[model samples]
Target: MKKKKMDDQHFDKTIKGRLENFEGPDFDPTALADLRYRLASITTAPWYARYRTELIVISALLFFTLFNVLWQSQVEVNREQSFIQVMDSLKTSQRIIIDLQQRLSALRRITSDSSNASSKPMTPMAEGKLNEVDNLLSQLLEEKGNNDPSVIALLGQVSEFLRSEPGMNGDQSPPATPLSLLPSATYHFPLPASSDSARISLDQVTLKENGGTAEAKEKHLTAAMARELKKHFQKGVGIRLGPAASLSAITYSPGPRVPSVGGGLMSDWILSPSLSMETGIIYAPRFYDREGSTMMELQNLPGVDESLGSLKEVDITSQVVQFPLNLKLYVPLSRRTEGVLGGGYSFLLYLRQDLEYGYQFNDDFDGRFQGLKSTYEQAKPRFYPGTLNLSAGTSTLLKNDARLEFSLYYQYGLGDSGLEQVKANSFGLRTAYWFTIR
Candidate 1:
């Protein structure tokens, strides 16, 4: 029992001696207090304070989405209203043409009866009424070229009656009234002869006035209406080619700028005089530069303690294509020039990538040395697949139904570039040559 007690006391003395020789970790009391204060403040902070940046970004996106949808709906409504107005105008013009035809028919009937009863002596009152009808018919025919089918039929009937009249049997010609006095250039129907047996052919009915044929006048009017309608609607296809400059690295990283070239085919639709939409596929050849180094520990020989750290350099290059849809608002600056503001979305289509890795030792302490290098080429999946863009530009009308446009634009990537924490942003100039159809 006494020996057990002595051994326990000796163990206690050895533990105390070791404690006296040990050293505790270096620490600052003030730093500990500060850390505790910071933790407590974070716990008591509002939720919005913790996620303020995320909340702002989400709110901005929601507002932009809502505004775009409402604007498109309103534009559609306006387009419908404009179409209705044009159709109404055409209907009203058709009704007026029908009324004119009815008046022409009634005059033709009365004149035909008068010519047939010419063998009977005419009283002064009857002759006056006939003259008045002839004057009204002449005025209606001269005001405009009546191409209505009903008017043409009535004219044919009048010509037949004049040819069959009994008064035309002798050398005595018809009375010198307005209808008989019409110039050859003013009438599209054959005139009656002094003899009943005299015949007239349909080919002799063509009217020419001021060196312009009836057919020519009709064509002119049709062309005028087409031009007027084109002022309200336009559609076209265009080809665009331009130089582009872009950020070659991930967003927030130092840009290694590179030159790029692009070209595309686009379809454009003008919803109104001032609003339009465009969509197309673009083939853009893009390039990126990445220069980085990594540190790795190296052993001079197998199972040896002596070692050195090595540095590795990595470089990468890529090429891609893009598809975009855009909306544009136009403000007329002159008869042939306009200022435009636009916004849109795009999708990326990746093609190929080249990666190179090179490594070397920091110091050549050992006589033996090693150099390692590798290169790989691969087809890439769709990378940085989505982007949003904004643009401002001007367009100038050119000859032969063509236009020239110039714009400056900024694009913001909405997805990663197939790499962690990497996005894209770019600014560029675009020029397009467009052909318009209406």
Candidate 2:
């Protein structure tokens, strides 16, 4: 063995010496340098570069969602603007009638006081004023269907006064009041019994013939009306509708707890800026299992006096309808977000209950048997007294006058669950999307 080892070492030395002295054909230094550079350039790519495709897909989805929200917001704004314009037009008509009433009253007083004045040659300015008033009255009378009874009566009075002028037969017209010089204050005159029945303040009505041009005054009034309407809308009552979902589990029951899922419609009525009332219905499908009592059936056996134990289990499935009513208080959390706390009651209706039983016999029995199963169903509808509900949530405003909400809730059963004296409490998370209506 030692001689073989020495021979191996001598052979390795001879090969090493021969290789060290050997020489091959010359190689290009440039080619070797290029190969080394290429090897050094290879490296693992960054995570972002490797996952660029997934990132692009996610970004596209986000962009689409944002665009859709923007479009819906624009639509809501346009609709509100259009409604404001319609209201402004109606208000303008009401203001015009009130203005005419005031001028008519002033003209009647003047006619009564000057009834005994002496006749004189009509001045050019007075004639022009009379013509203007007559033309305005004629224009109003032409549309008899649109004029109120009071307006028609005032027009008639004016016509009579014009005809009975003190100097009409002597090529003259009586002194008259200019429309612009009429009182620009509130008057207590009866209006038509309609939506515009309430008396209007003259100060609120922009005087077209006063300071600025009619067009400019009209635009200003429109902007002012819009602002007022928007303010009222913000502070006034509102309503919303949305779908809700929850994940819940039962407590203090004979059965093992399970996950319950369902969805339903929910609505809220804003009673004030920071307070609201909520009511809705939810449909829930539930499943649970409880340990069952042992039962035994056997033929004549040797030592067994009466019976033997058999494994038994019961599974329950139910469909329930929940009616919840709550009062929620809101506090602002940010520019577009709010935190809410609520307490209320939930009424439950059991639509269906299905109980399934299974039995497995022990092999100690000589009788040939495997397992037995049975199903019992109750179709009668019943009510589960009620439950007290408490919740905490956050609401985020969306672009289109809508809101998104996420909440955590707890419910304490007020009475028995009507299932073998089972009383249960439940807690879960809930989410809802809501839209606003004013």
Candidate 3:
């Protein structure tokens, strides 16, 4: 036991002597460079890497919004195309009806002249038949009631043509001359063999007989025309709904121009072709960073030099929300685009505020001035009328009749931002796409 203790004591003394005699490794200048390189790699990470989650969320939202707009546009395109087709068919039918009327009128004049030339001007029944045909023709040509005429009015005139004609030889073909209504062609009607002069017709023409099909087509065309006329002449109010985004910054000389990004919904009431009134709620998350120097006085304090007021830098950051009302006018730029001019009012609602006060000479205070930050959770006057905004922009009409708009705007603060001498003015660029609700 005595021998073991002596050996342990000798071991401890040997270790102490070795420590006193040992020299540390020589200093390497490359160590400072390696430390600096490590710090730079950590601090200079790519912006996208730092905000990858935020960027993904934003991208997903944008994709959803775009998909919705495209779906709505496709629906409108289909409806508008169908409407155009109906209008075209109605126009063609109108032209055909007018042509038929003109031809009937010419035939009537020819028969009248032929009757006057014949040796018999007698028969009151024949004259009455001619007058009946004339009345039916007039009804068919009347503007307001033209499309509303019944099958009887249309086919009855053809029957009237058959009956009202003067007695004719069976072998004769009437009127070989081209009618002005159909300037491209001439029509000849054969007088059928009949013993009775009052009645003339024993087959050959199918149009007068197939009244049902003709009536159906006429009814369809008439309905379409009516709908087209209503859409064209009716005075109706319209609304437009859309999403908008803005890159905004507050206007102040002392404040650093920290960019603010926000998006929100907007709606416009189209009062006329050229004018609109707009209103909407916007979730505008804005960051305001202001940094400047202010005079600070430090009177006699322990371990502090007494001096006059010295310049000290301070920084503040505020977050705000805005709501706006606008009136706008549109001027035609092209077949599918318009130029916009607008003015508006906005109400600002401050949500939170943060301030950092730094002492310029506080390094001498043994790190006491570090981490000097104040955060205010309560908003002072919750909401106030904020700014008067002026805007200019252009809107392009999409295939679905919706519009894509790009704008530049300036907002002049109507009130202060609760920061001393700092107004809440801002300027920004905005983009929106709107669809009309009729």
Candidate 4:
């Protein structure tokens, strides 16, 4: 009897194993259960003693496993798509920032231009409008869209776009035809476009018209963009114009940073030396991290205001001096001109000189000075160890990778930094430069 029961159990196990093997794409547990139920019902022989619900449950479990794998595949696909979208956003924001920086720097020159080079007189409103346009351009460029491009390309696109945007005619009202767009006007510089190829130039555009037939004006805007692009390229900001095609309003060859936790060293590097100039911000200071705590605490501070140490019996919290950081980002022009922006840690060591001591005892009381020999030491005890620095260097490149770099170096204090009263906290110099042997 035992042997016969064992044989029956083995047959049932074989049948269940065969049923569990079948699966379909995007396996639906509900569908599998129904299939198993139907199969069990079709083979319902009373002597067979079919466990119909058990078969269906086992089939559903197998299908669920298959469905889980498909769901995971979809998750992986979604993650990849999300990663791509983030990277695109970073590139776009980076481009917009770079564009706006270049734009405002150009506008500053147009407004402050004292060259008296242009024959036409610039109106105050026109100048104000130029500034406004700059602001608007900057704002629009930040948002990633199909229209965004370099200033020249962007202007051309803008002119084309405005043709479909029916604008108000100074009456603070919408146009009659919403679909039919009006064209914007382009503003030339106060000076005539010069023939000299040595100088640089910049062109301003106006979205409003000074004359009729705005459609023809839109086509002319393209010409304006080309002209400006040529000028900006050859002469830099407000420099002279070269041939229209000579200068490409491009972000050089660099596209974007590689997205990795620690990206591998660049595989290929391209160098193109031109008489190119640009204006942008850079990291002038070392990013602070808690990597060097022990070494930092022992150092002295530069430009510590002594006024705070002497205010025991007086109200002089307002007299405390805090030195703010200032940075300069230069645009390079020619092999002779250069710009730099870098930040790093600085350790201000002890002053290499003796201290000059003078104190005012009271207001306008004529008193003789004396160095009283107390137990207190007269010299500074602590050495000024400066923290990380943010620096920029502009220079003219010379022979054999040697360029004379004029640096704007800022030494920021980490723990004990303060401005020395009645003294300049920072100084600029036309410093020397040494290129790294790569």
Candidate 2: tens digits of C-alpha lDDT, residues 210-310: 44122213333433343334334454577887667788877755445677766677889988657889998877666766654422221121122223334
lDDT of each: 0.51, 0.64, 0.58, 0.33
RMSD (Å) per prediction:
17.5, 19.7, 16.1, 35.8
**Tens digits of lDDT, candidate 3, 57-134:** 467558857876777856745535665664454434443444455456655655555554535543454444345456
Instruction: Give stretches of model 4 more than 4 Å off.
Output: 1-332, 351-385, 417-425, 435-438
TM-score of 2: 0.46
Sort by lDDT, best first: 2, 3, 1, 4
TM-score of each: 0.42, 0.46, 0.53, 0.21
Report, for all candidates in order, the number of backbone clashes: 0, 1, 0, 33
Candidate rank order under TM-score: 3, 2, 1, 4
Steric clash pairs (candidate 3): none
What does the lDDT come to for candidate 3? Answer: 0.58
Tens digit per residue, CA lDDT, model 4, 1-438: 999999999999998988898665796899999999998889547742433433443455446445544544454333224434643443344334333333333433333343333334454543443455566576555554434334445566446533432221121122122111322223222212334222112222112222311111111223333333334333322211110000101110112111110000001010112222221111111111111222232122232234433211110011111122223344544324546664544333321222222222333345643322111112342334344456666656443333445555543344442122111123233243332122
Better of 1 and 3 by lDDT: 3
Task: Pick the TM-score winner.
Answer: 3
lDDT of 1 by residue, 1-438 (tens): 999999999999999999999999889899899999998888566868834543554465446445544544454334335644653543333323333333334334344545544354544544554454455455545532455343455556546644764442332223334333233322222111212111222232322333211221111123223333444343443233222223222332333555555555565666665677877666555455443422122112122222322434445555566778889898777656789899999888766655555555444567665656565566656556578979898988653335678888787888666322246777778876554433
